[model samples]
Target: MKFLLLSILISVAAAKISTIKVTGTVLCRKQKQPGLEVVLKESDSFTPDDKLSQTTTNKDGFFEISGQDDEWGSIEPYVYIFHHCRILKEGCRTRSRYDVPQPVINGVYEMSYIDLDIAQSGETYEC
Candidate 1:
C-alpha cells in the first residue's frame, strides 16, 4: 500500500503545470522611446525550434510570451527580441532581415514577470 501511494504522489508531482508571464517594451538606445513593434521569442535554446515558442507584441512596444510549464525547468531557455518597424519612406527602404541584434533576454531558469527595454547599439536590454 505504501508503494502504490508513493507512485501516485510522484505521478501527480510530474503533472504539475505553471504559467510564466513575460512583459516588456522596446526603445532607442539613446532616446527613451515607446510605441514600437517588438518581436519576442522563447526557445529551448538560442536556436529556433518548432515546438518551443510563443510571440506577441503591440505598438506600444509591450510583449508577452507564455511557455510550456516544463520549458522553464530546462537549461537556459533562450529569449530573443527584435525591432519591427514599418517602412514608410518612399526613397529610403527598411531592411528586409529581422534584427536579432542580440539576446534581449537570456538563460531563463525560473518563473518570472519580466520587463524588457532593449537597445541595438551594444546597449543592455533589461528585464
Candidate 2:
C-alpha cells in the first residue's frame, strides 16, 4: 500500500552511506604477483556479505580499490585476496580476508607490501 511504500522509502533514505578506500601491493616469493583477485566487501550479521568492488592486481602487483554501502550504522568493511601462492593443487587458490580497523573506517586504509609466500592466518584454499 501507499503507507507501506512511504515507510520503506523513509527508512532507505535515512540509512547512512559510508565509503572506504584501500590500496596495497602483493608479492609471491619476493616477486610481483599480478592477476590476483581482490575484493572489497561489507560484512553483514544476518546475511551474506555484500561485495562492493573487485579488481585484479596490476602488472606491478599494486591495487587500489574503493567502495561504499548504505547501512543503518557504520558499514564493516574488509578485503579479500585470492592468490595462487604456494599451492600445489590445480585450479585452486588461497583466500585471505583482512578486516579494516575501526580507526581507519572512513579513511584510506593502506596495507603495505603483503608477501603471499608466507601463509596468512585464517586463510583457506578454494577452487
Candidate 3:
C-alpha cells in the first residue's frame, strides 16, 4: 500500500510539469498587424515568479510562445498584446482569461488563431 501511494504521487508530480504551447495572430483594422509583442502568463498567479514567455508577430502577424509549468490547467492561461491601439492609455491590451485545452489523451492543445484587432472595438486590444 505504501509503494502504491508513492507511485501515484510520482505520476502526479510528472503530470504537473507539462509544457504549454499557444499560437495566434494579430490584426488591426482588418489587416495583419506586424511588429507587435505577444506574451503568455499564468492566469491565476497574481504575482507569479514565472518568467514570461513572449514572441513578436511576424510579417503576417502570427506569433507562438510556449513554456513549462505543472500548474497549467489549474491556474489557467492568458495572453497579452502590446500594440499602438492603446498608445494613449496603456501599452498592452489583455484578453479574457482562458484555459488551455487538453488534446486527445494528451495535455497539450492546438488553439485556433486569435485575432487582436483594434478596429473591432476601438477600445483596448479586444480579441
Candidate 4:
C-alpha cells in the first residue's frame, strides 16, 4: 500500500506544471524605432538548442509567449528575437535568422515585462 501511494505521489508531482509568460518588443536599429511582424522563439537556455515555445509581435511591436512546464519538460526555455526581411524580390525569397545575445529573457515563470529592440542591420533588409 505504501509503495502504491508513493507511485501516485510521484505521478502527481510530475504532473505539476510550471508556466512562464514572455513579452517583448521589436525596433529598428537606427533610431530604436518600432516595427511590425517581429518573430520570437523560445528555447532552453540562451543557446539555439532546446526549443520551448514561439510567438510573434503585434502591430505595436509587442509579443507574448505563455506555456506550462509540462509543455517543455524535455527541453528548456530560451527566447530568440527575429524578423522576416527581403520580400519576394531577387535573391530575397529566404527569411534570415537574427540572434539576440544572451540574457534575452528577463525572468522565467515570473510576471515580468520584457522588451526586445531589433536593429535594421539585424534584418535581412529594411522593413
Candidate with top lDDT is 2
| Model 2, total clashes | 0
lDDT of 1 at 112: 28
Stretches of candidate 3 off by over 4 Å are 1-15, 45-49, 72-75, 86-113, 118-127
* Candidate 1 off by > 4 Å: 1-18, 29-51, 69-75, 84-127
How large is the C-alpha RMSD of every model relative to the true structure? 9.9, 1.8, 6.1, 7.6
For residues 1-127, write the lDDT of model 1, one tens digit per residue: 9999999888766664433334554444433324433333334355565233546445554555545434334322334543333323444322121222223333223312223322224433222
Candidate 3 C-alpha lDDT tens digits along 47-120: 65454487888998888878765653443555666666434455445443334554511244444555444333
- lDDT agreement with native, every candidate: 0.39, 0.92, 0.60, 0.45
Candidate 2 lDDT by residue in tens digits, 10-66:
999999989999999999989998999999999999999999999999999999999
Candidates in descending TM-score order:
2, 3, 4, 1
| Alpha-carbon deviation at 71 in model 4, angstroms | 8.6
- Pairs with backbone N, CA or C atoms under 3 Å apart (clashes), candidate 3: 16-70
